[model samples]
Target chain A: MFERLLFEAPDFFTYYNVIFLLEAAARTLGMTLIGCTVGFIAGLLIAVLRQSVNPWTLPLRVIAIAYVETFRRIPFLVIIFIVLYAIQPLMENASLLTIATIAICLVSTAFLSEIVRAGLESVPKQQIEGARTLNFGAARTLWYVVLPQAWRVILPPAIAFAVMFIKDTSLASHIGVVELTFSGKMFVNRGFSPLLGFGAVLVLYFLLSYPLSRLGTYLEKRLDPSRRS
Target chain B: MTHLDVRDLACSYGSEKILKGVTLSAEKGEVVSLIGPSGSGKSTLLRALVGLTLPSAGEVRVAGKAVDYSSRKSVRELRSQLAIVFQQYNLFQNMTVMRNVTIAPITIKKRPKAEVEALAAELLARVGMEAKHDAYPEELSGGQQQRVAIARALALQPEILLLDEVTSALDPERVNEVLDTIRRLTDEGITMLLVSHEMSFVREVSTRVVMMDDGKVVETGTPSQIFDSPTHERTRDFVGMILKH
Candidate 1:
């Protein structure tokens, strides 16, 4: 395996193959980034909706709860297939990558919303009451008091989900999205040694996720209230 | 019109009644203290007054205007006129002492930033927390945080202050620092409704002391009257039990 990998290394390092792999890596990173970014925002909105006790938000809250609960329980791969079939008839020009990304967003939103909900709930009730009694309206209280405190609790897990999600984007390969994993399979199918092909894919995954975990650590320290002067 | 009038204010947690038709009133510039054993609904009354705990039934009027707790506008208006200090300090742990003091005034009230900060600085100094302006709540002692909490409430320039066991969470030695801060405020003429276990301080600063038991006001009198010559058996029993210690 080592000799075969060494022999294939030269062919694998060609400019065209390198660009192909790089593009695949970019797709993976792009999908995760766009999906998780949209997920975080949508998840935060859902979490806040769920937290609200006002009678007016009951329907929205129920819909949000249903979305979070339903999507969270379904397998991501099943969601990808569902999104793929679901989108095909709706739009003629929709790309496989777009469908895969939508699936990623749907699942991540469900998971991340729960993480954010926990983070929001972690803020002591007294803090909220303090804000309420101080005339900090719900939005103001959430912005100034709750979110700032919750970030410390929210960042670690949200970033962890993002990192894990970088790997999970490989599932998109089944839908012909040409992400990192599919790029590896493509190389294997093209007569390259499996070790060289998959090994390169492994390296790209690390390159993508390492910085994210580091970012999580950096954010955890930066946002830590105890660390703040 | 009374500065604060709570008429038959009742509240419940689920089925358990916390404040049962408890009527109380305070005049402008009056320092009224609620003294009671634990679970006597003293804190709940203050909570209800600020609309923190929704009253199951009853009415609260501030300066001749009845507060409609169901209305967001009414609650917001009531909160603008009233500020509360919780027993836990609840000083936004994420912010520095200065931000905690000035945030609501600057952001919520849309007050001028400089003016709010200047008032915050003065209030922090008044609370003896001048040097810790940039310190987070976790960095401060419980008493220090409570002082910051008081300054935070005062920066709003509330017409009435509800102090819910401000010193109850402090250490025995730390209680006086907070008590002294309230001592200075008592004469400054902010109508304050406080619930405290500090009997001596309550007696010393309260213009009138309300004795409560089982979610009801057993008696309302001058501090000396309730402490020395109580009229109700429950008040006497409570005052006797607490004063003995």
Candidate 2:
């Protein structure tokens, strides 16, 4: 691993290629941003749906549960293949990148929903009563009191899911989206150096996940007033 | 007119009845102390009055208006006029002591921010917690938190305040601080329905004393009438347990 990294060092900062890597990293970041944003919002709605007591909401809840269970149980690559090939006819002229993002978001949303639901449950029942006793109607209670406190608890796990979702963007390379993983694959094929190319992919994945994991830990500690000195 | 009336209130959790046909009343500015052994329905009666728990069969009227559990609006209005302080110090842990006091005023009453803040500061000072304004609930001692809880309850300017053993969770030395605050509120003539085992405080602060056991009010009378003049065997036993302490 060290030998391959040393040999690749001379070519590492070559401007044209560095630009290409930079562009690919940007696309990866974009995928993470778009995917997590859409996924978190959609996941919240689905989680709320799953908890809904209404009879009509039961079928919707079932569909959401089925969606979460289905994607989470299957491999990310398999879901990408199904979305890329089976849904090709539905895309019309839509870009592959957009299609890949949708697939990544759809899958991430399943796991994110469970995290959000658990976060909602972790909030103390007294907090809800505290709001109600203050005459915050149900909507205000949820918006102002419960969700604010729940967000503090939910944030750390949601960040973990975000990092996982970012890493899963690598699977999108199979569909030719030219993300970090795809660029790495192309470099390896051209140079006939699997170790150097994939090593860079490993570094990129670490770079993406490590900061978020650290940030998640930092936030988890910060959000808990009891943990602070 | 009665500021609050609970008529034949009955509440249950699944098969176990927590409150059995409990009837109680409080007039404006009256301090009524409901004393009993543990699990004797005093707390349940207070919770039911605030709609925190729906009674199985009963009526609760606040300031001449009926609280209809079926009507969300009625419950909301009733809740606004009623605030409860718990033995567990149920002030929101995430909020500062001052914010805990100001929450109802700002969020529910829609009072001007300046006015609410001013009143919150005043109430916190009244409870002798003005210095701990910015401190979060976890940072305070149990008695301090209970004082903040009382201030929080008072922020609504409610017609009735239900105190469920507010000092029970405090340390021995801290108990007097909370009790002293309650004593102050009583002196100010706030309408208070207190459930407490602090018989001395009950005798000192309450105009009327109620003895409850096995989910019923065994006796109700002036504190002197009930304390000096015994009525039932159960009441005598309850009085004996507290007086022995």
Best by TM-score: 1
lDDT (tens digit, per residue) of candidate 2 on A161-219: 88877888988898899999999999888773677777777887788789998999998
lDDT of 1 by residue, A36-63 (tens): 9999999999999999988899999999
Interface RMSD of each: 0.8, 1.5
Please give the lDDT score at residue A15 for candidate 2.
Answer: 87
Point to the candidate with the largest lDDT. 1
Assign candidate 1 its CAPRI class. high
Q: How many clashes (backbone atoms < 3 Å, residues ≥3 apart in a chain or on different chains) does model 2 have? A: 0
lDDT of 2 by residue, B1-245 (tens): 99888888899988999999888888889999998889898888888888888789988888788789867788888877788998888787767888888877887788898999999899999999989999988888999999999899988897789999988888999999999998988877678999998899899999899889888988999998889887888888879877997
lDDT of each: 0.92, 0.84
